[model samples]
Target: MKFLIAIALLSLSSCAVHHHHHYPDAPQTSAEPEYGNTDELYADEQDYVDDDEEPDSPAVAYPEDMPEEEAEPTTHQPEYPQYEPEETRTANQPKVPSVLQNCDVENFETGWIVAKCGSAELFVQTGPAARGSYYELSNFAATYATMVTNQETAYWGKRSAISVNGARGESTEYQFRAMKPGLFGGGTVDKDGEIIAHGIFTTAKTQHGKAGMLCLTYGSADKASCQRYFNALGKDLKELGRKNGPVMVGGVALRSEGKCHFLRPRELACSNGSLTWQGGSRQALENLVETTIAKWTDDHGIAGFYNPHLVTKCTIAGQTSTCHEVRFQGVMSTPAEIRHATLLEHQSLAVMCTYSTQESAPPPCTKFFGKS
Candidate 1:
């Protein structure tokens, strides 16, 4: 067995030695060439040219066999542009006139003089006097007397004798006569005897008119005084004119002690610290009046006015004489006007009346003639 093992080992060693000798460094193969060349391989015909031929500076010859690419030009544009705001005012534009500012009816000394013309037609005239001015008293009396007599014969009423003080001049005693019959019943007085209704009627008429004048005088002195006077007058007038219901005509007289011009009385209804009025529809003028009154009502305690049928009329004291003849006209009812009316009524009680202008103009004799 040992002899056989020795023969096998000798055979394996001879086989390993023969295998190593047969490898022979694995038959050598050549390597591949590099991508880019560092030196020039061929000389050009121009390189050999003499002075007669132009000498070439290191010519960068592009390969004629390769494809060519073109360069494109670029354009730049701004992302945003600047602009200016439009001006509201223009050189050729007509300047708008500033309208009169709204006045608070409640702020003034207010009094209502109402006469029942009948159930369907009741005449109401509320007068507002300037603060601390006695002139309004005369206005109240005149207006009350005028309203009472202006009605048709059917609604006509007469005034009876009643004592009046502080009338034309200083306090004086005077008797008042009714121009028509009383609407409060107990009518038809005998021609020989003085009417019983005159006492109460004249007292109410005078008191209603006087309250406005007194309020103006007292109110002008101070705001507190005005407020007190207004409260008192309101209580008194309300008590005296209690027969008249919710609806009443209201008037406002702007009397300037320094000037004689007479301005038409404006209608302003007062409730809950607000005053308002309706305007005519001739032009966009109606909007101006509405907005003006609204702004006044909003800023002050006064409310605003709205009525489609009511129109506003203006007459300077000297410009016209037919003050009572000019019927007050206002804007016709439109959807917007109706809407405003609804809002005003819903928000608070609004006093509404037609705005009338006087026909006769006051003579421009003195600045204080007819104004105050």
Candidate 2:
């Protein structure tokens, strides 16, 4: 048994030495079967990773001779870029000027005023003052212009003049006919006394014989913009006058002079004397006056009005009309009593309000409905 085991060991030793000496190296080939070349395979895998992003996991160990059936392409997901918050992105941006924030309508035939604002241009027009006629105001403006431009004439060579008798009903129009090119005739000043806008003005009379003044102004001297505005003047003024169609409030036909020249149209605020008017198509409560008070207080930016109590509730021309007596305690002025009237019809609401500080007299809320 010992001799047989020693013979078997010698045979195994001989086989091992023979196998080590006679075994052939791997055959060289032009094409690697998937991953035959370790250096070339690692380079191909590295190409998949983005230059900016590192792989999240450790480098994979690929077999030098991986089977073709098991081989697959490495996929490296590209990292997405991170962004700052919107507020952070805009932190250095400038705030809008307050003059551009609100439109003020103090003197105008129409209560409607609109503003066309842009990066290079701003055009605002006050329809007409309530008391002046075209003839008087135009003459006055011409006289004022002659006086003001007297000094500028030395450099500009000619003073600006208004074409008063050209056409009676023509829209407030202006030609870029200043004696010098790029010269503005007149302009509006900001609170800081900076001339922020230049004017292209025209004067005309409304259908009611009210003088209408249209001042189309611009911050930039772009001729294309000026011509565009000149073309749109007729349509814009017509719409401002509410001549687009009749605006019936509580069955009473009311004429809008134009949007309030000073107030933004979105605010829906209009005022005449002590009375304020706000109109909307949204269905308002016929019985509830809280909505009216809340909107008025918010829109007008006045101190909160309190002690609201119903003074009158009646039907006017098939629509429910209500009047509320509300008081406004002022800081410096006398504590004024206000009368708020809400005229409600189907899907329309017209809130007309008036105030009186005179304690000896009844609140003038009743007269406001008629005037409005």
Candidate 3:
């Protein structure tokens, strides 16, 4: 029994020592997954076009602080303004003659004045400086007949020199002469008792007292009515509703005027006057405009005679679009006029289609207005 027990104990000790030696403490590595997520990421399958298939608009970059989910996409289009019918209002000075209401004192700087009163319209122009004697008043006689009574110059034979008063009671003497006789006579609308007289004078009595020419025309149902014109010419004209001072009214900018009030570019103002709108987009508008311009340039623009404007455009600040005008070479007369007939998305879009001469191609109207 002792021998058998000793042999068993030796065997047990050998087996235990061998097992301990075989299992040395190498670095313990876990083939089993850790408690945390794996370092390697497997991407979900996505459908993407090749780099060459990108759209025209450049990609917009979002701020680094913005989250990928919260960032706006590059495919978004910016909003732009649109056009609506312009509302018209009657002139504030409705009782004033249409002519006087339309003619501002500033207009005198341009060498002409056009005004209207009750049943009468006055068109005044300053002629060239006279050597010594006043001018023949080239259009005077005809103009007088049109303004006062419809009698011709042949009807006024009575002549006289007279002093006329202005709007401010300042006395300006004029050389009144007879153009035709019997215009106001015998209580007749066109007889001698109904006399008509015409004169030419130089006065600094223009808008803001600027120097300009004055043509006088006076008529009366009788001598008493005629005398009032000579006594208080300015007062009578003012009481007739002529302008008293320079006004903000707009009109032709003649060469002498030396400045222009070009119409402004159309704007994209909303009813609340805000320039932007949510979800507003301009891609479609831009496409339509591009197509129209292309078609126009192909058909009529090269000739400088554009088709009637399909749209009305104005010039305004901060706008970026092509807007222009041209001085077409008028044959004998340069029409003393600037044509306001261009379709504009912005003042920058105003382009003069042609050079001054009909023979010349369109000059760089685009460049001139661009600087504006």
Candidate 4:
């Protein structure tokens, strides 16, 4: 009986060990995932949704402490408008007078040529001389008129001069009497209130250093036609002077009061206010001018000219000249004290004598000195 009881106890112990070897039941696991998540693990594998379809999830709100994202900056550009050029517009514009257009080419002449443009008569001449303020051709005309008509054909100074702005450039215009009574005037008055056989001569210096002249006569009661023709020729001459270099000064003869003075290049003169030249050493010329002024003042019972103060320096005839203001006591009072400009050059001296009451010298002195 003791042996049977030991065998039963051994069997019961083996059965208990076998039961302990089995695993405990996994804690409540289901086939679905935890936290009830239904989102796809691999989004690329899912089918694309149409734009019209509603989204599966609603927008999430950020926490109060979470930072907000900033939007990206965008750039904008500007647009501009364009217009036509000025030169192109000017080229398309119409000319006021067609006849004046071709006058430079068709009616152009080196010497005197009378161009009869529709209802206009133009007289033109081109000469050689560096541009000067004086009108040389008018001097010749005045001389010829004086000899032929026996009338005083002297130039009437600055009063007979006019400044004209032509199509090309500036022109110096001079008024003079034509030889024939009906030459340029059929009883027409000129700009200077002169109702004789009067005409105009326009002069200009080209950029190329040449000189040109254009002349026209008042042929009718209306002076507009004459002025128009004169301007046309002047414009042509200015253009021509640009191409043609220096040329001759056709003719120059100055007649003042009853005296006539013929001039050469680099020499300028007039009655009372004159540019007299002396060929001598500078010292000799100065001495001569001083002596003459002193003697004249002494003879006239007036204080002599003294105390030369240099005014400025200028070029005349390609030579440099020094100008001075020489003061003299007035004949009667201090207000009458006079000052004049005298020019002295190294090789040749050009003396300008002018009489004026102003503290400064007259136009002849200032004009020649380039002050004007």
Highest lDDT among the candidates is held by which one? 4
lDDT of 2 by residue, 1-372 (tens): 110001111122112100000101111111111110001121222111111111110111222333223211222113211111223323532232333333322211222333444422323223322222222233223222222221211000111334433432322232121222122332211112223234344443333223333343433445344434433433334323322222233444332222211112211112221233333323333423455455434433445533434467765556566655444443434344444556454424454444344422212234334311
Output the TM-score of candidate 3.
Answer: 0.27
- Alpha carbon lDDT of residue 118, candidate 1? 21
The full ranking of all candidates by TM-score, starting with the best, is 2, 3, 4, 1
Clashes of each: 48, 15, 45, 4
TM-score of each: 0.21, 0.38, 0.27, 0.26
lDDT of 1 by residue, 266-313 (tens): 222111111223222223333343443343233222234333232223
Task: List model 4 lDDT by residue over 1-372, tens digit each.
Answer: 110001111122112100000111111111111110000112122221111111110111111232222311211112111111223323443332344565433221112233434433344333312222222333333222222222322222111333444434333233343222334322211223332333444444333232333443333333455555555444444333222222111111111111112222222222223333333445655666555444334433435433333455656445566555444444443423233334345334434444334334333334444432
lDDT for 290 (candidate 1): 46
Candidate 3 regions with alpha-carbon error over 4 angstroms: 1-90, 94-120, 124-162, 166-207, 210-340, 343-372
Q: Which residue pairs collide, candidate 4? A: 128-247, 128-248, 129-247, 184-218
lDDT of each: 0.21, 0.29, 0.24, 0.30
lDDT value, residue 186 of candidate 4: 23
TM-score between model 4 and native = 0.26
